[model samples]
Each structure stands twice: as structure tokens, then as C-alpha cells.
Target chain A: MDQALDLSGNKMTDLGNGHAVIEYGSPWGRPIARWVPSWGEEKREVIERMRKHLVQRFGEDRGLRMAENSRNMIIFPNLVINDIMAITIRTFQPEAADRMTVNAWALGSRDEDPDLRKLRLFNFLEFLGPGGFATPDDQEALENCQRGYRNAREAAWNDISKGMPRVGPPKNDDEEQMRCFWREWRRRMSAAA
Target chain B: MNADAHLARAATASGQCTRAQVEEFLYEEAALLDEWRVEDWFAMFAEGATYEVPPTGDGDELDPAKSLFYIADDYVRLRERVARLLKKDAHSEYPRSRLRHIVSNVRITGFAAGIADVTCNFITYRTKRGVVDTYYGQHFYRIDCSVSPWKIKSKRSVLDMDQLYAGKLTIII
Candidate 1:
């Protein structure tokens, strides 16, 4: 995913003090103080079409739900959050790392709930690419939160898997996969040792 | 037989805490949770007992201090959490999602002195806003069998997923 914006056509002019605005050709286009980049006409059209389809399939409420969900990982949810995540990490803000994190968080109770949206920010941090947070403590907190989940969707039976291969030899896909898994497990273990 | 085997057998025989008792206790506890009786569920643990779901980042083990866990709660904290959830404004669970905790594969892996090591498999189905989510996991219990009916000295749940099923982990697994 090309996470960084194409700043080839954009210009950053210093507005005195520590603040500066990123201008995308037009003088009157950007939001007041906040940097919200406008989506190109093509992307906007595509978003509208997807939005309509989702609304029709899942109804109005749910259509909106799906759009709000994964906003961090997917298209820029409007301009503010996109600017925070995509822009701050590249340009460097006063708060730096946590700045974008906090700004992305300050977004809204829009997508999911406020809390779930905040949590999802950390979940989708992978898409943000690598960089340190504002403080070491902040980084540690994010890692701790990420590691807290069991992260299980479907669980494999260790006991049953070990015991219940087919009566015959490896004749089926399941058996083949299991054999492959065991072989790979052994290879990794031996290599590690 | 080794002394450890003898001791294990002796403990099980003396305590008379059969697999059936442990199974029953687990079921009753599940019922309270299904009913959203969080406080009653909290009472199932012994005083000063810990209810833990260890952070199995890539492996299954109980490392309290080093790894971050979904939940590693002492009795006091458990009480506080349950209390908070019971309030009307606990938005995460205010409406309370419907749930069915299907527990199976019960086995008493070991018994020694007052503590019995029992394990079980579970796949709980939760439905909220018409979306059904399945959570599969294993629960390991350290029961204090010294008493007539054993108390859950500690419980550690190992969920199968690397990340939570949904973004939110609102209920007890």
C-alpha cells in the first residue's frame, strides 16, 4: 500500500513561528490551521459508488458502519485523520510520533465507538509504517496493548491433531498439510537449536 | 511408581474431588456469565485468587510480569471491574451481547496436594447487532481441592486468535 501521499505537486510554505501549512496549489483550499488534503476527483467518485453499494446491501446504518471500520488501514477517512497519520509521520510534528497518534485518536466517535476507534488505531499501526512514538513510554504502552490480545479466530486441537491422522497413509489434503506442518515445525525447531 | 505419582494419587483419593464436581462447578460459573451476573461470577474465585488470560504472543505459557495479557486480575480488581460493568452506563456492555459458552474436552490432567490441574476446551458464540462471533480457547484451572467443593485458585484462558475476535473485548471469555 502506498501509504505516503504524493507530495510532488504540493508546497510547504513557512507561516512564521513553528507552524507551516502544506498547500496543494490553491490558496483557499485547505482547512483553517488543520491540514486536510482533498481526494482527487477519481477517488471521490469511487468512494461515492462504494458508499451507495454498501448502503443498498447493508442498509444505511450498516453501510456507514463498514465505511467507518478499517478507515485507518483503508482510504483516508476524510482529510484530518489521513493528514495526521500519513502526513505527520513524514513531515514531523511538534509532538512528533504521538502527535499523529493523538490526532488520529481525536478524530471522532464516528467510525466505531470512540474507544474502539482508538484501539483500532493501534491495530492498524502496521499500515502506518515504522517509526518511534513521541516517548518511549508511549511506544511501550502501544506494544503492550497490541500484545494483550489472544488473537484467536479458529483454534487448532493440539491433542486431537497429534492423535487423529487418517487410518491409511497420507492420502488426503488434511494429512498432507499436517505432515507438512510437522515437518516445518521440526525444521524450525532444529534450526533454532 | 515415582513419589510424585504416589502423591498425586493420594491427593486425588483423599480430596474426593471428582472430575464431575469440577465439571459441574464450571457449568454453573458459565451460567452466571451467560446471565450477565458479573458479580456472582466473580464470587466463584477464592479470596486473593487470580483470574488470568496470559499473553500468548507466539507461545502458550504463564508469564505475568513480562508479557501483557488480555486480563490478569486479582480478586479486588475483578470485583471492581465487575462492579463497573454492572452499572447502567458501562457502554461497552450496556445492552449486553447475547452469548453461549460451549465448554467441552474436560480432563483432570493432574492432582497433587491441594491443587488440581484441570483443563477444558471452549468455543463461545457471541451475537451482537446480528453479527455472530465465535471465540475458541482453552481454560486451565488450578483448583483448591482441600475444601469439600474446590475453589478456583486460578484460571488462565488461552484464546486461539493472535488478535481479539473483534476490536472490542467486552465480555469475559
Candidate 2:
């Protein structure tokens, strides 16, 4: 527990570079089977807050993954918050869940282009000036960012559809949602390029 | 030989556990889950047994105290989760998702004393109301053979997705 807590402090601390690595394949490239942890202490407050909210929204299993990487770069396109909403929709309104999974999400308007979508995320994180997402705290910021992030996820996935491994999205119209990290991947490439 | 190989050799050397016996044990467990036999499934674990669903990655060390897990349940919490599932108001499961668990590639990785480590590949297809989602993973079991029909000391399921592809882990994996 202490080791995990300690390593939680070992963050990359460089979203300034605006680059994050997205890894989806097996660590050992095994054609079969997978195992995976808790956050260490450096971001104790942040992690705890994220954990509480996430645990309440999703069940314990899926929620723990988000808290485990609380201070780490947010995994692209798979926001834990969005998952909470999605799961709720799935439970209460299966039709809505289908629509949400189909016609749904992002941090931006559905109309935003890929480039603008990239800029929105870059700005959303720093959230420094007026009109920026200035929440009372990181916890709220984490919660509030879901809708926009979902929108951003949609836009980001759209840009790199060709580069990503093309699996069919849940709905044909929602074909923009790619299978993996490429969801937020090519933005880093294009933003850096 | 590698440590895992050593473990595998040790388990079979006692010759008390056959490959078929292990396979049968797994199938029986799967049937209980398929029937939504939550209490029976819970009963399959030893008193202090754990069910560890780690992050969706490969080969996580899976230390409960140190590593982050998706579902890290001690017996008490595990029972609570099972109880919640049985509740009529549990939305995620009230309508009840139909799940089919396919267990394949069974292997006896390690065994010592009364415990044996078995690994198997799993692909679970969950269908609820009309949406269908498929989850694939590997299960690593630390099983106690001292008991009749054996009991799970620990079950570590590692999913293949970097993110959980399913909306919720409402059902047993």
C-alpha cells in the first residue's frame, strides 16, 4: 500500500508538452490472459476525491482503475465520468443508452472540428483565465469535464480513424468512436506536428 | 526452469490433482455464475479468499496492498457486493444481463502444499436489454484443494482492454 501510495507521486508532470503515451496492447504481447493496481500517495487528495466520486458512479471494479491513475494523464476517450453516465443510462434507459452510445458525447460542441477540439482540451487542462473551466477544486473539475471530454473524445477519434485499428463502433452513425487509444492519440501527433 | 514452470511442476508432482479435475472444477464454477447463483458462487471461495480484478493490462503483479485492482474484495466486502447483486433494486442487474462465460486454454501454472495456481483464458459476452458487449480476459486462480471440490483462494482476472470495454461490471466476470 505504501509503495503504491508513494509511486502515485511519481507523475509525468508534463502535460505542458501536451503529449501523453497511450498503450493498449498486452504488456507481454501474450495472445492470452491479462492482471493489473492502486495509486501511491503524492496525489493523495486528488486520488481520494476521484476515487469517491468514481466508486459511487461506477461499481468498485471499474471505478478503481480511474482512481489508480488519478494524477496520471487521463486515459484518452475513456473518461471514468462518462462511463458513470453511460452506465446509468444503460441501467435506467436502455434506449437512451443506445442513443447515448450512438448519437452521444465530448468536451466541445458536436460541430467542432478536430483542430479546435484539440485546442479545447489543451486549454481545458490549464483552465487559467476567465471563461476557462475554473472549478472550486480538482474534484469538481474532474466531474464537470465529462460532457466536454466526451465531445472531445468523439472529435479526437474522428481525426485518426484511418490510423487506428478499424473496429466497428457500437452504432454505425457513431462510427467515429475508435476501438482504443487512438481516440485521443492523433491529436497529440497533429498538435505536436 | 522459470518460477512459474516450477510452480506448475510442484502442483502436478503430488498427483492428487489431475488436469481433468481442474477443468471440471472450473466448469462447475462457471455453471453457478451462469445461473446467477451469487451465494453459491460466493461459497466457492475460502473464508478469507479474494477476487482480484486488476486494471486492464497484461501481467500485473496483482499485490492487493500495493497494486491497484478493479475489484479487490476481502470476504466481508465480497459478501456485501454479492448481497447488493441479489437486491431487487440493483439497477445494473435488476433487468439482469445475460452472460455466457467461455473458459479456454486451461493450464496448471503452479501448485504447492494444498494450493494450486491455475490460469485460463476467458471471453464473456454480456447481453442486456438489446445492447451486447463482449469482454475478454485471463483468470489466474490460486485454488485450495484441501477442501472437497476445491475452493478459490484468489481469482485474478486481467482484461485485455486498456479501458474497460463494458459499461459496468454488474455481473461476475
Candidate 3:
């Protein structure tokens, strides 16, 4: 778990007004090679082609930046934009204290190269979305947590203290991002009260 | 002429595969999935085959390249998916759900050269942990029948539902 979090290289930044951004790219802009072991020659070829296309379409520096880095940003309460291997815009609506519904959409650039677009779509389906390999597990984890919350009255508080003593930026696995959100949430609730 | 007769005529005109043959192939494929013989099912794909499921409510014409899809898998990724599912560690399917695949309304819409364009309706029920999920959809397929046993060149399953019933489609459709 620590290795995975470290590999994600998430650095959190509190963008006042209840918004926050977590920039996630491997340290030094290196590709997360571990994630691509299953990719064959054809898939690697597509990545190379897309890299060239990006470089040609948008100058060298910006194109490399676009191809390399990914970001996960939250807009206040519920909206999140995960611009990772593929871009996904997600929002959740809380229907009750225990139930909520989430809506997610994949975002892609218009007029993208056909092959690259296919790759982007493939990336989106591989990790994000309801049926993806990753999201189902995430949903399961969340549901498990909710089930455990049934005993919250006895268990009381949930811990959100990771990397709290760090002097510098927070790591991906750190709970600082959640703290940021909760801080804003508390401020708003106190104001309303 | 009725639709079946028209389709039969079209199949004969193309002289590639008959409706009965396509139906038999689809039935066999469905049986493999229902029995959880995923590796065998995976073997039925052509070398460069693609399997796709566009998001619910999206029409069949939406190109997976240009739009989002619930599942879009090329040959390599599809292979990986099969391998993952068969593993004992695939938490979502570790015990493997009981599945029943009902395929109907099979038709050979078009055939040319060695490829047959087939369409069918499917309703798959997945039962796990005492919960049942129903997935109904139309399947559009491009089957390459040049070889003795046909291989799937492309299979696109377009779901007819408005939303996922259980908020998650963990099982393969």
C-alpha cells in the first residue's frame, strides 16, 4: 500500500474556498511503469504514436507536460475531476445520511486522432467507470466501510490523521486531503449554525 | 417476405454463413459464459478482435474511439481481463457468480466476403450472495467465418437499460 501510494506521487494543495487539488504524476515526471506491464507491443506503439502526436500538435514542453502529468482536483463539496490516464468528471449527490448516488462522465478532446482517441477510451474503461477493473473494487471497499459504519455509535470517531506531523508536502496516502475537505465542511456548518 | 426469409436470402446471397450456424455459434458462446469457461470463450476471438460495451442509452452507432464506453477492450486487454477473472485473487469474482445467459432473436443481418454481421438480444442473470442482477442488451457482432470454426472479429453489446441496477456491473455482460 505504501509503495502504491508513493508511486502515485500525489501532492496536495489547498486552493481556498473549499476547493483543493492533488497533482498526481510519478516523481520527476517518470511514467508509472508498473501499471503498463500487461501492455503488449501494439499498445506501447500506440502510446509512442500519441506521444509524437502530442509533441507535434502542441509544442515540446507543453505537450510533454500534458502527456506525462495527471491531476485530481475537487471543486468544494462533491465534484471531482480526475485527469489521469484518461479524464473523468465525477459528481456525487447525497440523498440521505447513508446513501448517495454518483455520476461520472469521461471527458476527451475533440478532433483527437482516431487511434489516440481509442487509446484514451480504452484507458478510461480499464480503470474508471462502473464496470472498470478498478472502480468495482473501489465501490466494494466503500460499501464495506459503510457497513462497518453501522457500529459508528460505539466506535465513535474515524481517524483522518496520516502524515499530520510532516513538515513538507503530503503524500498520496496521507489523510491531509480529507482533512482539508473536512476543515472547510466544519467552517461552513459552523457558519450555518 | 418475412424478416427471417429476407435474412436467409441475404445470407445465401453472401454465401458465407447461414442463420442457423450463427445461432449455434452464439448459443455455444453463451453456454461457455454461463458455465464460467472464460478462457475457452476468450479463445473464440480472432487475432485482432475487440469487445466493447458502450454506456447505457448510447446508440449503437457511437464510435468507442470518440465516446466513453463501459467496457472497451482490445485483444491484449481482453486477454488480461480473462486472466484476471480466472485468478483466485479476483476479489469481485473469487467465488464466481452463477450466471445464466439467454440469447434470442438471432439474425444474420449481413454477410460479405468472410465476415458475417449478426445481431441478437440477450438477457443475462447473475446471481451472487443471494442477489440477482439482470442485464438485457442487444449484441452486434462481426464474425469471421472463413475458418472452420468462426471467430469473433468484434462484439459490441449495447445495453438497453437507463442505469446500472446495483450501481456496479462487476460481472462480465
Task: For residues B1-173, write the lDDT of model 1, one tens digit per residue.
Answer: 99678657744653666667778988998898889888888877889887766543544575544333456666766676677667755454556779888888777778778677888998888786566767778998888888755578888888887655353455677
Q: In candidate 1, which residue ranges exceed 4 Å CA deviation?
A: A1-193, B1-15
Which lDDT tens digits does candidate 2 get at residues B13-86?
A: 64687667888999888888888898999998998987767656646575544333446666766787788778
The weakest ten consecutive residues by lDDT in model 1 chain A span: A27-36
State every prediction's TM-score relative to the real structure.
0.46, 0.48, 0.81
Off by over 4 Å in 3: A1-10, A27-67, A165-167, A190-193, B7-16
* Residue A71 lDDT in candidate 1: 17
- Tell me how far the alpha carbon of residue A81 in candidate 2 is from the true structure, in angstroms, after superposition: 9.7
Instruction: Write down the lDDT that model 1 would get.
Output: 0.53
lDDT of 2 by residue, A32-99 (tens): 01112121243345435545667678755545444343221223443422211011101112244123
Put down candidate 3 lDDT per residue, A1-193, tens digits, no spaces: 1232233446888888778777666432112111254444665765666677777888665565566667788898999998776778999898887678999987766776676566667767877787788787787777668778889999977788988999888866677777888899999999999
- Per-candidate interface DockQ score: 0.01, 0.01, 0.60
- Please give the RMSD of candidate 1 to the true structure: 22.7
How would you order the candidates by TM-score, starting with the best?
A: 3, 2, 1
Compute fnat per model: 0.00, 0.00, 0.80
Using lDDT as the measure, which candidate wins?
A: 3
